[model samples]
Target: MIQQSLVLTGKQKLAWLENEVRDLKDDELLICTIAGAISIGAELPQYNETDVTDCNPVYPRETGYESYGQIIRMGKEVTGFAEGDRVLAFYGHKNLGVVKANKTVKVPDDVEYRYALLNTLSCDAAKGVLKLQPQRDDKVLVTGAGTIGLLTVHFLKNYMNVKHIDVLEPNDKRRELAHELGASHTYSKKEQISSTYYDYGLECSASKDAFHSVLNSMKHHGEVCILSDGNKDLFYLTEDFYEKELKIVASSDGWDYQKHSQWFFKETVKVPQLSKIFEAEITSDQLIHCFEELSESHNKPLKVLVRYL
Candidate 1:
């Protein structure tokens, strides 16, 4: 059976590769009919390559780390999940692929596939928000209104009981979206920095300047959660950080659903308002177009999904 999968050939270039589907091994599950795309670290510009001399032609590597689909086939060793179950996994955007059963999480029957696609992101946002240990009265500042940033805001307001939330985003659409998602105030980069000192800061943008802005606006002993990944060397330590004894916490890649009791995906889906964040949806064949749309800096789409037919 030939299956079509999207692969990144070079910087800003995507192509569909058709290949024969392989059978699932024991302890593995075969996913089919993928629902949405999750922009993992692979989509970042830093991973793109200018030189492609040594790159493979037929199976040019694919980017992205999370996707959702139905389990069409399960190995004999797979006990918890049966065929026809909707599951989310730490896998790339592919029509059909085999993954270890342990890496996949079953989606509830009531939860829509669009929300299920955000499971990995929800877990990441929840992890970062939990690490901050926000207080009910803490003045929170979130830098960046991207998907992770928005999810952080949602978790802070809905779960952490944080009020007086402020979001910093340059894009007008995203700033408005942030306000709708629970941000008490939203500001562009050129706007005058707020006089109110934030007790907690969530750094969700990759820009070093934004990081500095959040750091400067924080109060003494304030804790800031660094959620985005990029060139970190650009961020320098300053006198304010030392004088205030501020704490900067880095959250990344270490989420295990089996070990922890928190069900981030389940909890996030329960919030009906979050569904509004899915800004764009495209079929699997339009994967390249979706990437092109997301590549534009000014286009502030919160979430883009690639639905499989």
Candidate 2:
């Protein structure tokens, strides 16, 4: 678990440890981000105990995963990296962290620190592609147009090359971005989401209604890849899947092989096979999950990336 490795873990094991502990109580730390992504997409449901919030709890202090600034105390055993070395960690959300050197991917010096700050989102993007590996002529529809949603589109567009691709998102801004990137067609939930057509559906929005929407959008006996790492609305999932005979696939965790090969450590853009994921990360800060000058920050965007000082 040194500076340039990735780790696979269940939702969160020691979440309570990341709570508002007194500074004196806090001891023994390595690299960690100031914030991490708590929300996967737009319009999510309330979390239940079973939902298993990520390493950090929910906001008042929602974690911003993008642009994470790592901190290491005076003394810590690190391998292949130094005190000032910039690194990326998935546990950066809600200021959550773990003693995970394996999952920490170091940012290349040539890359912007903010771009390395984007590695966490790239993890989410990579996980989405791993979860939903579309085949030829698979008419695909991605629900939501937020960070994960658009990145899901990127993976499917650049990697999968499905017969047709679309996004069911309500946000005007997001829908526009989806089109700019790769969505063949973008529709709001109110608009016609096709009477019935689609082989695969990805629900990244985590909206209460998205489950049913995917079910109804499918052409029967279709597969819906559940990539959103957020809590699922039980009532919605149960009712839709039972009524529609929908096939659901819940895929979590990223690729172990990619982690081992230093996918994150290498120059993200230079990785031709993975250029789009990094492209999504590079554009992520200015483009997606944008927070305006508003009253509260969390409810606004899909993910927030900040410039670290």
Candidate 3:
């Protein structure tokens, strides 16, 4: 079978290419995509061809990690999921794809497809929050107001019950949105932060300066979790690190998707603001033009959602 796939052939290039769909393995499930989201933090570098992580980055890279759909078929050996089960998987922008059954989590009947699409990112935020172990009285600081950063704020304030959470972001619109999503204070500049103020911090901006600002804002012996991809700007330990004796830890993917999804589905009802992150929507066919717009400097959406169905 031939399936259409969204691929990046080169820097700032996107194409809907055709690919052969091989037979599924015994433990795999075939999914018909409903919707997916562009991970701006991770994909922007690949789109711009400015990824600093690789001296000579490879081209024709498959882009996307947040997609969910209904299972159209299951391998003979697959268990615990039916043909029509709604599931979220790490499959990219392809409309049809196969994934291991263990890699997917069933979407609840009540959860909307848009909300289910955010399962991966929500779990990413939850992982960091759990690692930080924030308390109700503890003041928190989060860098960046992008999707991951904003989601980090949501988890810290709503789920973890952190009383005070400040955000660092330069964009006025994003800062305003951050305030609406429970950020107590928002700063456009690092100089505005008070020294030794926050008990815990999370770096989600993927900027070295933002990381430095996080370290500067921390109280003595403060702990911070770095959640940014950090491929765009490299992070370096600052003087505050040695002076204040801060502790820094980093979290990437979620520890348990199935377990986290069960809790996330029930708890998301309380966080209606999650919808704000995915305000921009486009059809799968418009992806090429969407990437062109995203390549321009001024194009910024909290998150761009692609509807396949």
Instruction: Identify the candidate with maximal TM-score.
Output: 3
RMSD of 1: 3.8
Q: Please rank every candidate by lDDT, starting with the best.
A: 3, 1, 2
Query: Which ranges of candidate 2 are over 4 A from the true structure?
Result: 1-29, 32-67, 70-77, 91-98, 229-244, 256-299
Worst 10 residues of 2 by lDDT: 5-14
Give stretches of model 1 more than 4 Å off: 38-59, 231-233, 257-270, 293-297
lDDT of 1 by residue, 41-86 (tens): 3364523442222343333567667677888888888999988898
Q: For residues 230-261, could you state the per-residue lDDT of candidate 3 as single tens digits?
A: 78887889999999999999998986889888
Q: Identify the superior model by TM-score, candidate 2 or candidate 3.
A: 3
Tell me how many residue pairs clash in candidate 3: 0
Q: Give the local distance difference test score of model 2.
A: 0.54
**Tens digit of per-residue lDDT, candidate 2, span 1-309:** 222111112222112122332232123236544433334342222222244344344543222333344545413454565656556655433232443555556555576553354455545666666666678677888887766777677667655666478898887777877886678998886357874588788887766577668877887677787777656444246554665577787756555523622555454454333222222221223222332222134435444443322
In order, candidate lDDTs are 0.74, 0.54, 0.87
TM-score, per-candidate, Cα-based: 0.86, 0.65, 0.96
Candidate 3 RMSD to the correct structure: 1.4
Cα error, residue 89 of model 2, in Å, equals 1.7
Cα shift from native, residue 57, model 3 (Å)? 1.5
Question: What residue pairs are clashing in model 1?
Answer: none
